[model samples]
Target: MKTITKIFTMAAAVALFATTSLNAQTMMETDPNPAPKGMGFKVGVGINGGVFRDKSPMDYAYGADLKLQWDLTPYVAVTASGGYTKLIAKDNAVDADFIPAKGGVKVFPIKRMYLATEAGAGIAIQDGAKTNFIYSGGLGYEFGGFDAGVRYEGYVNDSASTTYFRKTGQYAVRLAYNFKL
Candidate 1:
């Protein structure tokens, strides 16, 4: 699982650097209008489905997140998100649910394209409402009012339901609509 996390982290870093270099080259050749520095707000909701890395084949997971973004610069923003996740045990129909809240930075390496990473915490309602640390990283594109992306997320806990780092984490494809407010 650590190996998988390292691989994903490296991949994300490489993609970010490559995109940043390309954006720099493009900027040198073309003068694009600057994005407003004034504060801005955007709200979005997205859904994702994935498997727990440590869980057996029978465990299926899905979740939804609501996000609030504050654009501080053309290439930078701050984001806060919270959501609910459900893990279903296919064998016995047992279910575990969680609520996660996290905050992170969003960086746009190119127009309408972004890389974001965040960390915070989560609460598992089962097993006596245990709390765990949470984190995620993702890449996404925003076109007009629509956004789509993929992210890897994990909770750092070793519970009877989710055996801590054993499952590694989750990889999910996400889609959302961001409304500028």
Candidate 2:
């Protein structure tokens, strides 16, 4: 399918270009000088866990997230991640299973903690319903190239045809480290 190819295409491109190029893939790489020596234009791998609500908040849910991080600015970066969140129910439907593409601004107001806010759109697949417009916000932390962070996210449909509303969402703590090519 086109969608599958598109997704793989992006991943392969990232891996191919990233493995051969010795620059950060995210924010800091774009800057002439980066505070975090190995920051900016970074492509990192991470894992996280949190809660995912279906159409309603009453649904009990849990999830694991996997994503790639890119810091493209002296103070900003973009991350793309996908996750499978499951709802505890009879049919065992996945509460949140989506490939989210997000971008936001980040500031190192203090060491380790990053003051950040982001806006992004994603395609969410849940219980046979395909939703769009996934967004989130929050602060994060980093140490020795390892990052652990969290956020409050919202999901909606691309068009007005969406029945889903805002729900308090969380992500697993992630750590991002860099390696030399």
Alpha carbon lDDT of each predicted model: 0.76, 0.55
User: What are the per-residue Cα lDDT tens digits for candidate 2 across 1-181?
Assistant: 9999999999999999888957666754353324345444544456555554554442444555555556655455555656554433324433445556666666666655676665665556555455566567777777665667777665565433232434345443444453322
Residue 107's C-alpha lDDT in candidate 2?
68
The best candidate in terms of TM-score: 1
lDDT of 2: 0.55
Give the alpha carbon lDDT tens digit for every residue of 1-181 in model 1.
Answer: 9999999999999998888845334434542323345678899988878765545533667889999999997778999999998766555754667788899998988777889999997777765546678888989888877889888877666555442323346777788888788
Compare the candidates by lDDT and give the number of the best one: 1
Per-model TM-score on C-alpha atoms: 0.70, 0.54
Cα-based lDDT at residue 116, candidate 1? 93
Model 2 C-alpha RMSD vs. true structure (Å) is: 24.0
Q: After superposition, how far is residue 16 of candidate 1 from its true place, in Å?
A: 55
Q: How much is 85 displaced in model 2, in angstroms? A: 4.9
